[model samples]
Target: MNLTLKIWRQKGPQDKGKMVEYKVTDISEHMSFLEMMDVLNEQLTNKGGEPVAFDHDCREGICGMCSMYINGEAHGPDRGVTTCQLHMRMFKDGDTITIEPFRAKAFPVIKDLVVDRSSFDRIQQAGGFISVNTSGNTQDANAIPIDKHAADEAMDAATCIGCGACVASCKNSSAMLFVGAKVSQYALLPQGQIEATDRVKNMVAQMDLEGFGNCTNTGACEVECPKGISLENIARMNREFFSASIKG
Candidate 1:
């Protein structure tokens, strides 16, 4: 297939960026989106032109680093997959693909398709973990009985990869879904009960501090999320936050 790619190019955070067009010919449907990009970069490099800069690692879709806004959709037209897992088959021959970086005030563009997502790391650090006593007196995690339904829900929430699709897809660039998932992953588990109050409060505080917008219940985040994280997590987080507020 022959394809025209209109990709965003920016030298730095302060650089004025625009969509630059490039053409790739003879692309196979079997090639992953990033692989097709590799072909485009190879063409550019051979012609002594600068290659397009996009973030990608572990192209199998686990790393959550392959961030792209394709034709106004997070992770392209496909559902429940990251940019790296997208394939050429999703587009027809001679298609014009518009590729851009995931836009959010919290995620400042670095260069080309790369954006600074360290804000997510900071949010996680705010209180996404539990303090476990590893001493001899500590109870065995396996011995603790957890309700199957709660365990399943917790596992579902744990699937969030922090890819920012939730933020990019939201009209307000809300990180609530992501934060909710992170919070729910703990809130539903017995091990997380100890820090539940501080966990929700601190994570929400950090999310707000990072300039991410508030959620208006649009449900765009769950629709675009690769892991299919549920809106129920957001509700759970809200309940946790409200309870924490009352306790304080």
Candidate 2:
């Protein structure tokens, strides 16, 4: 198949960027989106031109590194899948694809199709872990029994891979879905209860400090999230935040 790709090109974070067009031919429908990109990069290199720069690792879609805004949709036209999992068959010959990095004030572009997502790391660092003393006499987590329903929900929330699609899809650029998932993963379980109050407050504070916008309940983030993280998690987080505030 032949296709035209208009990809965002920026030499660096401070460099002026624009959409640059290129054409690729004979792309197989079975090729994953990143494979098609590899083909394009090869063509560009053969012509002594700089290739497009995009992020990808563990192309099986586990890493969430293959984040892309394709034709105005996060992770392209697919549902419940990352860009690396997107296949060529989703489009046809003569298709014009517009590819860009996830856009948000918190997710500043570093180069073509790549953004500095260390902001996510910083947010996670704020308070995304359980402080368990696993030293000498520490009890194993299995010793505690948990309700099956709560465990299931917590597992669902933990599926979040920290991909910024939630932020990219939000008109307000909110990180609530991502933050909600992180908070809920622990809020549902007993192990996470010890620091529950502090965890919610600190994570929310860091989220606001990172320039992410407030959630307007538009629910675009859930629609675009590759992991199917539910909006219910946001509601749970709001409750958690309120309860934590009340206690203090």
Candidate 3:
């Protein structure tokens, strides 16, 4: 396929940026989106032009590092798929693709298509883990005997891969879906119950401190999430937060 790519370019966080256009020819339909970028970069490098910079690791889509806004959509037009998993075939010949980094105040661009997502790490650190002791031989996995329904719900919530697509797609740049997923993952599990009150309180507080906006129920985050993380998780988070607030 022949394509025109309008990609954002910036030297640093503070540098002014703009969209620069490039043309690519004879791209394979089977090529992953990043691979297509690789081809574009190679051509630019050979022409003595600076190559475009983007982030990717584990191109298989497990890493969630291939963060790109393609044609005004997070991760292109596909639902429940990340940028790394997007394929060239999704576009046709002569398609003009506009690529930009994930846009959010909390995710300021470092350069080109990379953004600093350490805000997510800080939110996770707030209370995304269990605090139980496991110093000795761990108890059998079956010993806890979590209810099947609860276990399934928790597993679904735990599938969140920490991708910032939720923030990227939100009109308010909310991290509610991501935070909700984390909270729901533990809220349904026995091990997570002990600190449930403190967990919700601290994580929500940290999320706010990170400059993420409040959820407006536009449902954009759930739509763009590569994991198909549910809006129900956000509802669950509301319940958890309200319950915790009252207790506190």
RMSD of each: 1.1, 0.8, 0.9
Report how far off residue 212 is in candidate 3 (Å): 0.8
TM-score between candidate 3 and the true structure? 0.98
* Model 3, global lDDT: 0.93
Q: After superposition, how far is residue 133 of candidate 3 from its true place, in Å?
A: 2.1
TM-scores for every candidate against the unseen true structure: 0.98, 0.98, 0.98
> TM-score rank, highest first?
2, 3, 1
Put down candidate 2 lDDT per residue, 18-81, tens digits, no spaces.
9999999999999999999999999999999999999999998688788989999999999999
lDDT of 1 by residue, 47-138 (tens): 99999999999998888898999999999999999999999899999999999999999999999999999999999999999997778788
RMSD of 2: 0.8
lDDT string, candidate 3, 168-247, tens digits: 99999999999999999999988899989999999999999999998899999999999999999999999999999999
Candidate 1: where is the Cα deviation over 4 Å? 135-138
TM-score of 2: 0.98
Per-model C-alpha lDDT, please?
Answer: 0.95, 0.94, 0.93
Checking candidate 3 for backbone clashes, the offending pairs are none
Instruction: Say which prediction, candidate 1 or candidate 3, comes out ahead on lDDT.
Output: 1
